[model samples]
Target: MHRFTRILTRVVAPVGAVALAAAFTTASFSPAAADTAPAASGPAQNYLVLYKSGGSAAGASLAAIAQARGAVVQNYAQIGVAVVSSGASGFAARLQAADPSVDSAAATASFGVSLAGDAATDAADPVSPPTPAPGSDNLSGLQWDMNQIHAPEARSISGGSSSVVVGDIDTGLDFTHPDLAPNVDFSRSVSCLGGVPDQTPSAWMDDNGHGTHTAGTIAAAKNGIGIVGVAPNVKLAGIKAGDAAGFFFPEAVVCAFMWASTHGIQVTNNSYFADPWLFNCKNDPAQRAIWESERRAIRFAQQQGTTVVAALGNFADDLAHPTQDLQSPDNTTPVARDVTNACAVVPTEIPGVIGVTADGNKQFKSFYSNYGVGAANVMAPGGDSVLQRTAAAVNGRVLSTWPASRIGSCLRKVFDSGATYCYIQGTSMASPHVAGVAALVVSSGVTSPGAVAAQIMGTADPIACPDTAMYAFFPSVDNGAPQVCQGGTAYNSFSGNGQVNALRAIGG
Candidate 1:
């Protein structure tokens, strides 16, 4: 399984302690180098450049772009987004200087994928129902999260549509995994590494297991061999935006959403936040540029009729009233800084995107889930080891399909068929459940993304906060501060709307 130790959400810091965000960025990409260095060993460092709305795509022609000491690697004409590569100093500045119509320009940020803590070893812990569920596949008994969302009952009403494609835009997918192979829409899958799209299926393969696990939860087959997905009958598209190392760069994110919009993707599941800042504070010029470019790509996807579902993140912070953020510029050195409404986590806080938080079998917020009154749109089972632990399910983590080739400390391999599975916990594991539900809703006759989102909210069950006074006493995943919930049964921060009801979502 893929495990990332340094993400904004995964850092288990002492209270008031500062920590690094996932895959800290290199401070600079200066052109200075020794002559003894070999030829460029990797893809050209790319930048995400977005043109102002209504700007002419041709205005960014090759001749004009060359003036910036950069060349276009890929041009998304419809969205006015371009991925450019340059070794020149002040690459972004040079590009903007050459084109005043460009709305924003920032170096594409990189990220290393985060791994859920010790989930693989926990899978080996003794589980109840020693065998599989009577009518389910091999690992169904371990999937309490599915039952929590009523996936079994929902699937009975609608298992999702063959034409409704749900794209998993993360580390990529393992097309060969038996459980996932049957549902993967290979023709729609592509690798958007370095912001350049490669149509070859192998290029989109899951070098890291995170994408495969999320894929399983969204659309793993119901072939009586492995665990079933929330919407077992829908087509799953793998948009390989995160690289082999688990980093999700800005260029890849822009490409992924644009790809989904152009293709027939009805929905997309986003688990990781875009780099290099953990929170893109609009007050900062560079950070504002990052958010603006990524926002344009996301907004364009929604405009194209794709419903976006994203994780609220594993950082147990109150997103709406953020006070201090010690983990900015995760791709580089992080500094302690205060933030306000001007700062926002991309995709999660972005309007129109369905933001999801995590809960456990106990129905409480996962210690690591980020929440705020207006931030999270819904909640799903993300698992909790501290609160939901039981003798059978010691870790209380989410179990899903795993990549067979990837070797990591937190992996649970199946020896019989060389196929594999693993356990992980995070909003990363939670968002796909909602995305699957959204796919089912779309398949069940709700035709538009707006309509699908409305159905998801309208069908959710309302939940009230648990002992507000005791919030300060509850243990948190980050071991920093206890979490608190606000609002009533109708809406709240901890469990938005309510835990996603797959059965209700599918008209059950």
Candidate 2:
């Protein structure tokens, strides 16, 4: 049993505060680096240049320089540029001299930038890594328990029938992971980095572990060995929109949605959120344009019958403040104090997405989980009991998959070679459980993402308020005011539709 208490909702300090928006200018390419004469050439060269302006501009300059050098400028963007060069040696100096503003340049070969063409060929006809067979190290008995969930059983009855493809529009995925290899549709995977046009799957490999863990929850191989997934048989795809550092620029996210539309992917899971302050500045044209564009993309996905699942964010708030203060019981107004504001409740509030919140067996929303009436749609298990794996998980434990390399690094730094995995917790971990469940619903011959969402919402167990006790109390305007309880009937501004019951969800 989990304690749930209702507390007034108020705006508190921002979590993971975002810097104020900065004005940006387009990057100009240096004409000095451009080759005037046609190539009386030897071997064709490829170069990627980094500029001071931004990665997007650096890419543009590289394209212009490629044209001047008699080589073709394949693609250009703000951060970096890629070009096929006729001559190799003094290209860097020539480019620098061509434009004083140009910051620096490097050859793609020197940087070990693998082309999508090469990566695809390798993936298509490659040797498999020595991954331990699934279930080989079933060290945790959790897998066995998850198997009893209705989603997986429904998938089995359908003979693995779901053809719906869900796009993970976040960080790239580890395409080579043994648990995910069989189910991922590599053909649709794309990266928005340099405009290298081959749609081959190299971009799908997750350098950061966030996307991989999400992917695992959605469709980890059900080979009766590794961790079982909610929709183990559902088709999954990856969109490499996020960078290695886990930051996603608006351009990248927009491009990813356009790419998903073109690639025939039907469902997209966006387990990422932008800062709430962004909406506060709703008057900015650029920000408004970005938001509109996001809305358009989501609408486009819906037109194509794609379902979008988003995280409700992890910014928990108190419901009292000057900006959001409630009247005191004594009929006296007090000075406004900052209260916890539900900041993570943005885009989830956007029309099309099925926003998910994190819940544990205790049935209460995670302390970090944001709450608001139209913000979260459902809650799912995101691991509770702590297991030693990573620094973040040291306090709140959530069971899920992780990249072996990253886990090893953390283990080496902390406990030496003794640790292989860490129990972690976050709405990020919870989003996938819903995504997987959605996949299961889709696989049951449902074509509409909206329909799948409806089924999920309809099937969840309704929890009643005041059904549980308060775990703790924080000072608010009214001391005796009822705090939120874990389980409840009628939606409490916290856990929506109660915790997801896989059995009830699949209508089994």
Which candidate leads the pack in lDDT?
1
Model 1 misplacement above 4 A: 1-11, 16-44, 56-61, 109-135, 411-417, 468-482
Give candidate 2's total backbone clashes.
54
Candidate 1: tens digits of C-alpha lDDT, residues 1-508: 1125222223244454445444433354332332223333343467767777765336545555676666777777676777777665566655565677877677765421211111011011111111111246777778898888988877766777677788999889999999998888877888888777776888899887889989999988888877889888888999998876667778788888888888768899998888766678887666777787788889988987789999887667888778776655555566666678898988788889999988888887877678888888889988776667765455778888888787463444442255688877888888999999998887776757789899998888777777745345343333344577788889998888988999888777
Instruction: Report lDDT per candidate.
Output: 0.74, 0.51
Per-residue lDDT tens digits for candidate 2, residues 128-193, read 111111232242344322442344444444323335567887678777666677787877777754
Which residue segments of model 2 deviate by more than 4 Å?
1-140, 143-162, 193-200, 275-280, 318-346, 384-396, 409-422, 466-488
Q: CA shift at 338, candidate 1, in angstroms?
A: 2.2
Residue 440's C-alpha lDDT in candidate 1?
84
Q: Report the lDDT of model 1 for residue 476.
A: 39
**How well does each candidate superpose onto the true structure, as a TM-score?**
0.86, 0.62
